[model samples]
Target: MSSVKETVDVAAPLRIAYNQWTQFEEFPLFMEGVDEVRQLDDRHNHWTTSIGGVRREFDTEIVDQLPDDRITWRSVAGDTRQRGSVRFERIDETHTRVELTMDVEPTGIAEKGADALGVIDRRVKGDLSRFKDYLESRGHESGGWRGRIRPADPGSPL
Candidate 1:
């Protein structure tokens, strides 16, 4: 497994930053290679992505979610095996810091080679940078889901 960690500071409040992050369907706008994300429910999502010329689909289940703080998820079933978390920190009343950490398992030669060449790390960083641009440009979130998902509630709905 390979891991990538990246951080970015956005000119928005913690609530705005965190709220934007919850709209998974908008990820394709800022997240490179993410073709589409369907939020099946509050704690479930289906992702379709094309990375390094390879297209894949995956389903993820949110393991834990804390409003305006952090959200964690792991792939439940799909063509990829991975897990990740996003954390939100308040820098000030109008500034926020967002951090992302992900663990990915590369399958086949192409993916393994890309991971070995630090492509994944660069991608993560670029994605976060774009996210900063996206939120900063809008000056607010398009919409938000502030609901909490506890570890004990795996099938929670939005």
Candidate 2:
């Protein structure tokens, strides 16, 4: 598994930034290589992406979610095996720090090679940067889902 983490400070307020992040379908506008994202439900989404000429379709289940704070998900079924989280931190009334962390398992030789070469890391960083630009320019979120999904185990809290 290869882990990649990246952060970007957006000029938008924390609520605006966090709300924009919840609009999964709009990810393609800022996330490079992402072709489409369909929200199946409050806790599930279907994703289509082409990265490094490899196309993949995956379904992710949101294991935990908290409004205006963080979202965490893991691949439930599909061609991808990964888990990740995005955190929103309020830097100020009009600024937010967005952090993303992902752990992906390379399936084949090509993917392993790319991971070793830091391709995945660079892609994540670039994606976050684009997200910042997209949100800052828009000044508001397209849509938002403020629903909450607690962690799977009752004993654990997020």
Candidate 3:
């Protein structure tokens, strides 16, 4: 499997960074390829993505999640296969570092060719930058999961 990872430091607390991400349904607000996300279960989600006019849908299972630390997932079934993790590190009481690592195999030869040529990296980086900007602009998480479809409770904040 091939991989691409990127990191960014945010001027926000770790909980702030983490809670925002835990709300996966909000991803389309920052992610470009994401058209929609529906929580299927606490650890499962369905996502729709579109890039360069090609649209695909996939279901992924959250392999692991540790609040204020990391969230990992891999495609359970889809047109394309992918696996990735987003890790959050508390740099200080008010600063956090976000790292993303993703390995993806395109479903078609055209998408594979584009990946070999660096298009995918650009898209990934752009998405991260957007997330950074959006998070910073918001200054706080908009809200959190209210749907009962989630597998586990968020529990009380520490």
Candidate 4:
């Protein structure tokens, strides 16, 4: 598995930054290589992505989530094998630090080679940078889901 971690400081307030991130369907606007994201439910999302001419469709389930703090997810059923988390930290009233960490298993030789070359790491960093710009320019979130999903208790919404 190849692990990638990246961080970016956004100009928006913590709440604004966190809220905008919950708008999963809007990810294509800022996330490169992501063609579409459909929120199946509060804890599930379907994603379509084309990276390096490789197209993939995946379904991810949110394993844990806390409003304004963090969101963690794993691929439940898909062509991709990965898990990741995005955490939000308040730097100040008008700024938020977003950290993303992901672990991806390369399926084939091409993917493994790209991972070794730091292609995925660079893409993740670029995505975060674009996210910063997207939120800063908008000045407000498109939408937000404040619901919680705890890994220990799937049926309970905390």
TM agreement with the true structure for every prediction: 0.95, 0.96, 0.88, 0.95
Candidate 1 lDDT over residue span 1-158, tens digit each: 99999999999999999999999999999999999999999999999999988999999999889999999999999999999999999999999999999999999999999999999999999999999999999988999999988776456652
The candidate scoring highest on TM-score is: 2
lDDT of the candidates, in the order given = 0.94, 0.93, 0.83, 0.94
- Write model 4 residue lDDT over 67-130, tens digit each, in one string: 9999999998989999999999999999999999999998878889999999999999999999
Better of 1 and 2 by lDDT: 1
Q: How many backbone clashes does candidate 3 have?
A: 1
Q: lDDT for model 2, on a 0 to 1 scale?
A: 0.93
Question: Which regions of candidate 3 are displaced past 4 Å?
Answer: 145-158
lDDT by residue (70-103, candidate 2, tens digit) is 9999999999999999999999999999999999
- In candidate 2, how many Å is residue 88 off? 0.5
Scored by lDDT, model 3 comes in at 0.83
Residue 90 lDDT in candidate 3: 95
Q: Candidate 4: worst 10 consecutive residues by lDDT?
A: 149-158
